[model samples]
Target: MAALMLQGTGSDVGKSVLVAGLCRAFANRGLSVRPFKPQNMSNNAAVTADGGEIGRAQATQAIACRVEPSVDMNPVLLKPQGDRTSQLIVRGRVRGTLAAARWREGRAGLLVDVLDSFERLSAGCDLVVVEGAGSPAEINLRDGDIANMGFARAADIPVILVGDIDRGGVIASLVGTRAVIDPADAAMIHGFLINKFRGDPALFDDGYRAIEARSGWRGYGVVPWLADAGRLPSEDAVILERSAMSTGRRVTIACPITPRIANFDDLDPLRLEPGVSLLMIPPGTAIPDVDMIILAGSKATIPDLAFVRAEGWDIDIRAHHRRGKPVLGLCGGYQMLGRSIADPHGIEGPAGTVEGLGLLDIDTILTATKTLERVEGIAGGARFAGYEMHMGETHGAGLAQPVGHRADGSPEGAISADGLVAGSYVHGLLALAEQRAVWLARIGVDAVGPDHGASIDAALDAIAATLERHLDLDAMLALAQRAGHAATNG
Candidate 1:
């Protein structure tokens, strides 16, 4: 099977976005393509079509490939549980928690599972585009590493390094990587790609050639900052860039960013609304003036819950609700909006109960079983498609008035008696055109913006067009599959 892998000089060097763009670019050429990541560490996750969970980036890549996401796409997933320990997910199921120190000692065996998943995804595909985690330059983590060079060596996949030029010193980052890594590992990388370039490319021509001269690697053209990249959902990092809600918008919405926030991409559609001005309130800040406030999902709910109270956001939310402005929560945030949250089994953390924001007349209990599914529902009288990913069950007076119904006609979410407060386990409710319009209308906006899904498709196509125009697609494709380097041991 033919495959190519993109390994970064460092994290956030646009490796995930580049792999996603190439996946779409190749798929658009009528070639069957699949996206793979051996390991991913992020609280942002996507529930697979088969009722499993993987990194959100893989799911975005799956959308680019026009296929349903599967656990095979991301073999080992790591969800940070606040402390040094992480909850390990293998092939979509929880494998229990592992501390940073203990996980390193046992990860070599996990490579077998990683490769098995890659083998399955590689079957019957024209090409498989793989993404490496963090950077392979850290020789300290090289022994049992299944994320970067080790995975490439195990799978015999060709590697192309990527570096962010916008961050400056692209030449050093690329050349420095070659200088530090083992000779065998360095030999595996055939070329390098410079990403996030802005202004004149000719200004860096000497630096570009210098990278090739020092590293003995070919240059794969520079990629300017993608203009349409904002339309796509970011996978790993939380959106920290905050500004005032744009003036003259009919509705004002505030979404507070928690310390361990997860799946905040659910708010992407709202940012696209012309009549909606969305503000991302940072931690340790009071909720600002707005017609609506949405509490986003959190990886560590109890701790984040305590954090919210410590920041006095609980008072801010209650004040917002008292003014008759709406308050909404998703997943973990949904658990925090109820009367109380009980972790009797200590599924998330210590076994105890915490007082909630008390917006909804409901109580929740954390359990070991997690619900993962993609379903359609009705919200504010509009049919919508969304997904459920949570591990809590709620029961109280709020259940008497559900916010919507599932595709299978089961009730979901809850709406307050005064219609000013609600909480739901469903995510991506505003992504669809109808639901977005319904939400806008509820907040007194008369109009809705363009279709979110179409906008994303257009953005993906624009990225592919950029690749076909600026990058050497054929040469990169060859580099992806070509591998002929003698290596020394790490």
Candidate 2:
């Protein structure tokens, strides 16, 4: 197979976005390209066109490739539910939960599945662009690893190490990775690349040479921080660390950052609205006064419910609703807005029942079976599409006033009697232009930007154009082909 993997110096070093950009850059050149990550640890997921679920990053990368996303793109997805346990979803279906110890012990066996998926994808693609999870230098966790260098060594895939100069000491980062990993593992790396460069590349001329000199790996071009990066969906929650509350937009929307928040990218579409100011209400801070209060989804609904109560956000939500301000909930957040949540089977952790925020007349019962599918519906008289990935089934009088109807003509979601509060299991409710415009009109705002999907499409094209000018795509493709030939000869 013609392939190469991109591994980062550390987590959140922009590996996902870079791989996505490279995928688009190569696809633009008329090559059949695909993106793969053997294993991923994220709660931000997207439903594939094939009626399966995968990490949102891979789905976005698939978009860059102008193809429908498949579950094989991300074979193993670990969504953290608590400190030492996560819900494992393999090939788009729930495989069950694994404790920290069990996960470490069983990860090696999963390599078979990961490789199976990779090989299947590689069969038809001209170039399979692989992305590695975390850093290869974390030797402590290298044993039985399938995410980084371990997978590269297993698949005989060449690698290009990426470092974040924007984080400083990238020269040290690139060199130090070579210094830390086994020499055999280092041999798998064909070159190094510096990413998120801010100023002129000339400023890092010496630094670039030093990294190449120390590691004996050729330097790929330095990529400046793409200002349009915000237009893309984010894979890491760390970006929420410094999420600021803006002051100038005509309408303000706030969502409290729950500890185990999932699919937070639902807020990305809000960024496209020039008249909207979006904010991530940080912990220890009370919910700010805003036009709308969104209860973001979480991987652990019960625990995050307790978390919301502990932070007194439940009180803030009630007060906001009393003031006649709109409150919207998606998935787990929808569960939280109900009168109660029952988890008798311990499906998510120590089985128990918890009281919800009681803003809406509804009850949710957690179950072992999870719903994962792409769906389209008409809500508030506007047609929109979204996905469902939840383990709870809600039923109550609220169902009578369904917010919408699914493609199958089944009732979905709910709008309160007064219509000031709404909740749903949908994740991408406002991605469509008309849907977003309707949402804004509900808040009495008369502004709506371009179609959310179009914005993302244009941004992908921009990123491809950017990489075409900066990165040496021709050389990278040549390197991948050369490696394949060398392996065949050997």
Candidate 3:
């Protein structure tokens, strides 16, 4: 009945990845393990097979544990929006938007529901490994903090503080983090794990002792830097940085790095292609004359649309259309290419009117009723099956219907005239081998070199195999079992 919480010294300290590793490790021990994050801030989301929304990290963790993902895994998801506001998702659906200050003041009331979900999941599982967001030492925002220390404190779960030594000053980072957290919160950290250590673990022997000595915390093990994580479906938008092109072929995509980008995973399949170079042009970068320009999904579509206009990318996109280059949009990106996007429910921004790029002549009205479903659809005359989660509806006579069919052979997305601009609510449309290969072929890039899904699965297996080599699974399970027993007693 006890849970073990994994807290990091800071954000991006490998907490998510470590939690995933632990989940796989526990499952390998024949224990039914589940992953939990009371709250998460991520735009990379995954639509469960049942049509619910959850953080992609949790989804990946579910994959690691070989289980189906549910909303209980990540009860609260905060996706950043422009102007100090964020789009809040609760119980796998969009609740509304709240400024950071307002959210902090109002979120405490929701912790009960979050704990209810956790309790429900914990009841059915032999072990649950909870992942913490950000850092426990963020003193300023700890009042309503149910994600890290707060969640651990509420659940009475023992914590394993993971620090990134590769980022330098691991000892200081761990010790300082421990020093700043409130006493009650700090007491929950039963041990610490040094992750992403590059060089010899023996060389940092003194540093490990320094952290243990300085913080008075136990050292689990120094996990080496894992390079095989490429095998998993990435949940971080920053993964686009690794996309490269082969010698003669390339895929040119213009993705405006807005203040709140979401569902950026739509570009993943392109990154794996040796012949495709996925170019994510920021605001000031010239919209290069490329084969295609992709408008990715966004959490804050209304404002991000204005951003596209402000950065003059809208003009560039229009030019690309005029020049007969192919352009594709997904989810929010699809909404932006339409004639108009109306926010009647104040979901994304202040209740207002926003004009779309007018490329599709469709009008989308934002509604409180979210459209979340696992859809099978057609795109560019290809059969594609994917999930769709959105809050807007599009309708117009000039709108182009879907080109692909679902499992039942039903048409699902919108393909414009001349088929130059295509839009879909599906995020992973390219994960299908033929879909990607055909898209790449259209863009003058060859993508038939490797099967994308098999390659990704192999990569995930490699990451798991690598971590299995580095960490002691038996020791970790013993740690969790000890924590769970203590939690039950407490």
Candidate 4:
């Protein structure tokens, strides 16, 4: 099998989108393509068909390849629970928490498993598109790096360095990466691609060539800003800062942007509605007047609850609830809506119990075990398929008014007596058109949005077509083929 890795000059440089677009582009050519990322750091995760969890981006890429997502696509996932510590997931299961001081060492030991997953993933594939984490220019952490150049060198995969011209300093970022990284690591990069170019591609030809001339890498092509990229599920939380306000929408739904927000894409479908406006309320801003408020998933329930209170959003939510506005919570957000959340074992942080927003009568006890599964359920009389990924079990009288039921008829989620407040552990429910329509009707608006899943597939195809035009697909295929030949002969 042939493999090519895309490493960026820095984070949010469009490496994930590029890998995904290429996966679709190659798969469109009738190649058996698979997506692989040796390691990933993101709280935005997706449950796979094998009952495991991986980065959401890998799952999207799997969709791009028209394949089921598997844990082997991303063997090592680091879900940050806080600024200094992260929950480490290996092969789709949580291993333990990794501290900042031990991050380099902790990840170094996973190279064996990472490579093992890579081997298994590429075995039956014509091409495996690999995505590197962060940047190779982070030489200080390069000693035990398994996310970028280190993985490329060890796996003998060819690397294509990608630079974001929209971020400015593209010439310096690309050439400086080669200048700072170890010479051995630099040799792994076979070429360079400029991404997110706003204006005409020819306008940046001199600058693009300057990077190749300075770094001794060939130029693949310059890709203009892809409007369809916004339609795909984004893995980075930084994109939340760029959430634009939709004007003249009939209904508005607001979600507070918590520091440890996980699976924020749960609201992406709502953003697509022409009659709906999804507002992501950032920190220090009070929740504005809206038809509904959604408490999104959180990586650290206790800490994020504190953040909600600290930002005075708790006050805003209660006030909104008093006004008879609807409120919904998912996963950790559901935990935060409970009467209390106990973490005696310190699974998230210090061992203690914290009072919740008291929106629901249920109580939650954070446990060591995590639930990771893809499920189908009925909510609001609408059948929906989603996944559950959480660490707490919630129970209370509020559950008597369940929001839905599982396929086996087990009650799931809770609703308030007034039916204005609801919470569930299921993520991606909005992606189902029926479920989304039900929620829209609850907010007094008719759903006019297209099928969310179908829209995503169409967006992937559009992106593949765009990449085919801007990128040198034949050259890229030849490069990957050469790597395959080396792997076989070596």
- How far off is residue 187 in model 4, in Å? 1.1
Estimate the overall C-alpha local distance difference test score of candidate 4.
Answer: 0.92
Cα lDDT of all candidates, in order?
A: 0.86, 0.89, 0.79, 0.92
Q: Compute the lDDT for candidate 3.
A: 0.79
Q: In candidate 4, what are the lDDT values of residues 305-345, reduced to their tens digit?
A: 99999999999999999999999999999999989999989
Candidate 3 C-alpha lDDT tens digits along 1-490: 6478889888888888788877777677688888999998888888876667899899889877889999999989887867888778897887878898899899888899789989999998899999998888889989988888778878878888989988898888999988898988888888888898877889999988988998898888888888766556666666665544345545555566765678887776776666666677765666778778888888878988988888888888989989998888889998999889999877775798788898885788988787777776556555566688787888875454664667776555577877787787787888877777767776677776445556655655666676677766566677778877876776
Residue 25 error, candidate 4, Å: 0.6
The residue-level lDDT of candidate 2 at 146 comes to: 90
TM-score of 2: 0.98
lDDT (tens digit, per residue) of candidate 1 on 171-289 = 88999999999999997898998999898888889998999899999998999888788788876654455356688877788988777888888888887888888888886678877
Where does candidate 4 have its weakest 10-residue lDDT segment?
A: 446-455
Q: Which residue pairs in model 4 clash with each other?
A: none
Off by over 4 Å in 2: 487-490
Residue 184's lDDT within candidate 2 is 94
**Model 3 RMSD to the real structure?**
2.3
- Name every residue pair that clashes in candidate 3: 2-484, 231-459, 231-460, 376-406, 378-404, 378-405, 379-404, 402-413
Ten contiguous residues minimizing lDDT sum, candidate 3: 241-250
